[model samples]
Target: MRPFKKIAGIAMSLALTAAMILPAGVRAEDTATDAPKIVISVGDEQKTPEFKADETKDLEISLKNQGIADAVKVRIAPVIEDANTWPFVVEDMNYERTVETITAGNEVMVKWEGLAVRPEVESKYYKLPFKITYEDGEGKQFQLDRYVFVKAVAADKPEEKPEEPKPEENGEPEGGEAGFSNSDPVVSGGGGGSESGKDAVPRVIVTGFNTDPGAVNAGSDFKLIIHLKNTSTKTAVSNMLFDLQAPSSGTEAAAEAPAFLPSSGSSSIYLDYIPAGGTQDISIALNARADLVQKPYSIAMTMKYEDSNATQYESSSSLAIPVKQAARFEFSELEIAPEAVAVGEEANITCSLYNTGRIKLYNVKAKFQGDGIEGKDVFVGNVDSGATGSIDGIVTATQEMAPDQKCKMIVSYEDESGKASTVEKEFSLTITPEQAPMDMSQMVDMPAEKGFPVLPVVIGAVVVVAAIVILIIVLKRRKKKKESVEEEDLLDEVDRFTEDE
Candidate 1:
């Protein structure tokens, strides 16, 4: 009983101390600062994306933020380790992807394409791990571990007699050839297969392909080299006719003009023969359309050939060629309001960012720099093709500039492949010196302004002098009249005295 009471007392004391130290109603702010629950999943067959050895493929995953707070600066990288055979990309290549922010209840997709799987891995399922790190609501970074399953299947091949099943082994093996069939179709690079009679038709497929300059740009001509292989043990294909079908223009499945066309004459090219288990490389000159959009365009190669027994076999394969649109643009009438500013004063800069190319521009930003002024960098998120984005900002004068100086505005944008491009425009902006404080003594000694009214002041002074002279003349006349009246009164007084005598 004493021990139980002691433990309870300790617990109560700790709870009181924690309550005194922590703030009130703080369940949310602290809890939301933890790592977000980001769920990574794939909606593919059997819930696992399939990959082929010695082939390039794409894998896409969906990320959903289930926590209350948003995940910011989310960086996810497929944990590819060479020591363990998780071969998804070449060495020294950056496979990490960053998401600016994934708000709660929203999902985004991340994909890795052109991933070349190592040719030595056996056919089996692999548990793939992904390293995910993100900032929480309190600007605290944390890591959330997640995993996905991927399936590796054998490369597709022409239908052939499967080897006989081997006897049961003593113990179970991870990936072995114990249970087998003599007639199962193997998965091939072309992603399809067919079965006919006892003797199956030999398959002619494009095992791989490459471009001359490697990167195919729109409106330019490039050489495409395709590798044709006869996946047969003993049969030989001869007199082959390969037709390359470029992707159409419209969204409908119906036929339309293709985005790519052969440089010379027809899309059909001739190949002599491909012996069994042998490969052949054929090159074709193709010119991409100038108006082609920025995306991977699929080209279908239709093959028609004859076997040794004069049997006609037809097979079709398609490959996607990524086409990049050139980033081309020019500023439309640069404008600088008040084209002049004093020290510590601002000038308004306005312009229209026009996208004249077929590709969309992303992360558009602008900054002004010159001899004595600088502007705030403005971020214009995205600008579509044939669209105009407005840039309005202010540039403050940092120092006094010489007469007739020029200031420049630099506009930068990135393409779909993350390649950056910039365009600069220079405009004249005058900077005047700041006004000086006034002094009392200097104000008294300053000269009068130009064009003062000096003639009017002189005329008013002459009029005042003439009025003073007229007043003085009237006063003298009044004094003389008073003296005469006094003398007449005295004479009258003398005559009255003589009559009284």
Candidate 2:
């Protein structure tokens, strides 16, 4: 029994160890077989080709599928940087290109022609970097970065030659057609390597430009017309395309391109062909941002075209257009009439506004705004460029206001684009307590000064006279008693006289 238990325990330990070891081996194998392999390089003939300043050269790149999977939609482009130090620039767009497929053990080669180099660059070896992007059969994409060094050589200068004949009668030169100016061609090759006359490559030039409103103002939409001319006298250009490139650094303050302008993705216009000595005019609508400065801003234009036999070429030019600043105002000489206001009193304020920019302002208004204060807004109508205007309003102070308090005076206006702006001017306030009103009804009810009463004395005299009348009546009664006898004698005399009558 002990031997059996030992055998079973040993078998269990072995099985656990096998389970752990097999997974690591399987993971290693899966990782090794998961991804595809590819090889890319600059062609052997192009690896050490001589590069010249102010000259265009063709670059050949080769790509090979080294793994079992096929590559799909293989994209290739060149990326150059450090323009201050890099002696060469790819004059054509190198963003994207596609190849349908490259099966296992298969390879593909591509050519990038007409790369321009600076004229003043010295002879040296320069590194050119290229980016290749592709996907496998499962649509999984991958990117590879590769580079090659090229030697730059000094270009030989062209030999001096006799000048051409002047324009003859009927306005035509000896070797040129009528209406052709005797002045130098609008576009000329910068490189000294190419021979003069018929062997020279064709070029594109911007001959003239104009704006719809005759001027460009910040925050305004305007039309831009450009006249493009081909400088080649013998080669006609075909499949011509035009594009505008905006600066990335100052894009927030740059002029904007409408939907019609090819600011991104594709070219704005594609002409079937531009004949030799012919001109084409293109138009674009642009809007200047509000923050654009009052100076000339550059808009870069790039042209891509092919010659009569389908050889592609590209060139770029810039146009500097002046921009006028938008309407901007400042609060100057802000006067708070009486400086401070008393509670429950009408306060008056005035402010002077100055338009410091070239744009005009409309519906200019100023008013006093603060807690416990009320005022009306004063309208100054419109103010012209570099002009001054004044606005005044009245406000009433509330009881909550305190002495030496501070409040803001807000001046608002609109620019030519109907954009509103406000300038706040803070001023100190002196608030006083409200006075109490006088009461006239209380004065009418007030007591008179303390003194002897004349009416009371007159009443006392009437009472005394009544008492004297009663006493006199009593005294007269006593006298009548004494005079009874005399009255009887007079009565008897009267009776006798009556009988006699």
Candidate 3:
């Protein structure tokens, strides 16, 4: 009993001392002369602070010594309790800024820049908690915390109208992923009271889609556009990648994947980033297979993205596209400019290549081949559906070619798939033997088969005989004259000698 009484008495006395000392401590802290007034602003504008998502803004904080005495070694800093839940990012500003002393009734201002908002978040007000730590004149340290409200809105599209409000809720909040209560709105990025768990992830939803041409033609190229919306209010999504697949399942035609052309060297596209509540557009160029049935075809789209913390997520979408049938071709006429040509001579070949199918033919080319012929390839380029195009070529007959020969004309064309096909047509060629050069000596006895001219040859022979006879007569006259001159010289020499004697 004595020990119990002593213990009770000591407890009561200690309680009395605590009650008195706590009041003194509270009074010391409450004294107006020991504290300073502090204010925080965003630049010169301090009222109704607001900023857009993904924008960096500057912060200005001021400290005033409202006490009766100067405060020594004064220091202050701002802190955020929960960064993931807060709408803004706080940077370190105290390391480079400190006041040695703040005189009584004087004030000091501090500025910290580069505070940004999370992207893709809807317009809303955010409550951010901050802390300020400083010392009084008598070396008494004090710490305080407060909340600052900032409005964050979208940065672009001023003309856009706000979404309509839904009717009042009557039932329990809709269910969500595990660890989340049905009562709270689904917030994918913000770290609220109930959403602060580490497992919180972002979700991306498909809004809508469209195709460049409402209907596609078999063996044709078209474009596809897909729209996406980020449903996570607090998180910015990134590394957006998608895999576009044509339905290849179940039926025989479905067993093969749809034919998709690559864009920018790859079929899959990477968007890299999408802000919260923002929309993204993806465009892809594709080609429908030529053999596809004339009906709607299904395309499967798979999307993968990451949140602010680099957590990956996936979703899927589907679409049915319409297709039309392919084109056809027919050729009816084949003609050569001349019926006959001599060996080693050139002749023109013409053909009418008609498009009999419903579609056009592209890159039409024609080539000729024969046993002994030099043929040229012709290009008709493009022939419209139900239209006719002329394919002309020049070919030379070789020396080995016979009087009657067979030649082949090959017409090649490409389909929408870029596959090449050829059609071959056979035609008869009448070749004449090459004419032999004229010979004057053999002209008179030559056969008519040779087609040699005889009148010119006879005239040439008569001229030659007349020239030979005239030449012989002139030679004889020259010999007679020479003999006469010799005789006269001898007689003159004899007369001169007699006169001298």
Candidate 4:
């Protein structure tokens, strides 16, 4: 009986162990069958779509469940940089469901529309991000992320636009051209919209230029005025700068002027902003040297500015002004002989004239006009530019002419421009009887001739001889006079002595 009981207990324990292990395998198979499997793809249905500021567009997302079970707790949420914190926002988001469940071989279409917040602002592109989440029957969650791009266009009325031909796929019009059907997803951010289809470059035009005192003398100041207008329909010009350049042969003279230009060359002026279809004025003061040639010189004005996207734009225009030369002249000293000439003696006279005008003199001629001047004595000729010429001749007075007779002499010349000029001078000649020449025999007592005169030595000897003779006579007379005075005084003293006794 005891042996039979032991066998029964062993059989029971083995059976219980087998039952517990078998069910665990079956439950693992069930959990595997209930696991969720999903695939998510987000894309644009149109190849390229333009959305203006504050505009909304739909994005299509395909969700599929490849497992044998159904997907549950499906949720689609867009994750974006906080528009308020970033100064840009997507105002709204809406979703459209195509089918309730994704079967083993079926797919579900989810469409979402996103709105870009419109602010009274400039231009830029905005990007919005989206994320999709779902769970299977076993409660396993899956997530997928995606993005799309839009633009913030101006709020003005829509302009007329030409229709573009639709692209063909497999040699056929895609989606019949009713609307844009297939496109890649676009991502954008910031306060402005995409300018992909619009002209990214701004256009600049040089309208006109003017200057005060259209004509100027060298070394004078003038003001240059530049006028400009913005022609781009979309861009606002900022930090506009202009360079004023004189003609190739001319230069600017002010030191405080813009230094970006040459010392005698170019200058720059600044403008803060120029809106589309708006105009602005720029003024600059210039100084030209007095020595500048007489001719028309051109002033060229160039403009440079940046667009809304920081792109550089440039343009230029030119205007011309005439530069005139100033007037200026100098005279030469007049020449006369002795300033005092004896009658019957010849006198020489000479005079010269010069032109100092900035302008050239053409066909220049000189003439002399005065009394007692003979036609042959007067000299006349052309004075070459920037040069001096003289007139010289001898004048002889008649022997019978009265003494101290004065005669006027004149000199004249014509400018290269055929202008006449004159100068006058006066001189006198004295009349005196002529003396005969001395005989050679009278010169025998003289020593060998030397340059200059020996009259100074002869005068000195005469003075010394006269001084010696006067001294000798003065000593002899003083001795005789002293003796005679002594005799007279003695007799007077004798008489005085008798009277006293």
Give the range where candidate 2 is weakest over 10 consecutive residues by summed lDDT. 175-184
**By lDDT, highest first, what's the ranking?**
1, 2, 3, 4
Residues 1-501, model 4: lDDT tens digits = 474456445545544555564465455444444224354433323222344545455555555555556656666665655654222344455332334455564566666556344554333333445666555545455555544433344456685684673222122223221111122112222224425544444455556656578656666777766666676677677777777665334323543332122334447788999887787877777776555544455555666777676656566554555556553445566565434433333445555556555555444333333343332333334444466555555554345334355565555545433456555555554444432222222233223333443344444544554465456556657867897899889989999998999
Put the candidates in TM-score order, highest first.
1, 2, 4, 3
Q: List the residue pairs that clash in candidate 3.
A: 119-276, 120-275, 120-276, 327-359, 328-357, 330-356
lDDT of 1 by residue, 1-501 (tens): 475456455555655555553342243334434234443322212234678888889878777775566777888887766535585546546779899988876788888877778776545445567777776555456664455556665566696785763322122122321111112223233323434553356777677788878878888999989887787767787888889877565223523668788998689989888898889998899998777766666777777777776666667776667777888776878676566656655566777877888888999999988879865687777998888887766677778887667778888989886888888888887888853222223233333333655434544544554355445545656766777888788778888888888
lDDT by residue (tens digit), candidate 2, 1-501: 475456455555655555664565455444444355543333433335667877877666666675566778877776766664566664554445567888777778776666677787755445566677777666456666555555565567796795773321222223221112212323322323333576356676888788889767777778878887877887777787777644432233342432123323343766777788788888877776555544455566677777766566777766666666666777766565556545654555666678887667889877777777876566778987778886656566776676556788877788655678887888866766753222222233333333565334544554565466557667778888879978999999999999999
lDDT of 3 at 493: 88
**Per-residue lDDT of model 3, residues 82-130, tens digit only:** 6666666544534344667777767777665677777764454454545
All models: lDDT? 0.67, 0.62, 0.60, 0.51
Please list all clashing residue pairs in model 1, or write none if there are none: 155-187, 156-187, 156-188, 162-182
Query: What are the models' TM-scores?
Result: 0.49, 0.31, 0.28, 0.30
lDDT of 1 at 350: 73
Model 2 has a clash total of 0
The CA lDDT at 474 in model 2 is: 71
Pitting candidate 1 against candidate 4, the one with the higher lDDT is: 1
The RMSD of every model to the true structure, in order and in angstroms, is: 31.6, 46.7, 54.0, 63.3
Which scores greater on lDDT, model 2 or model 4? 2
List residue ranges in candidate 1 displaced over 4 A.
1-200, 250-255, 437-501
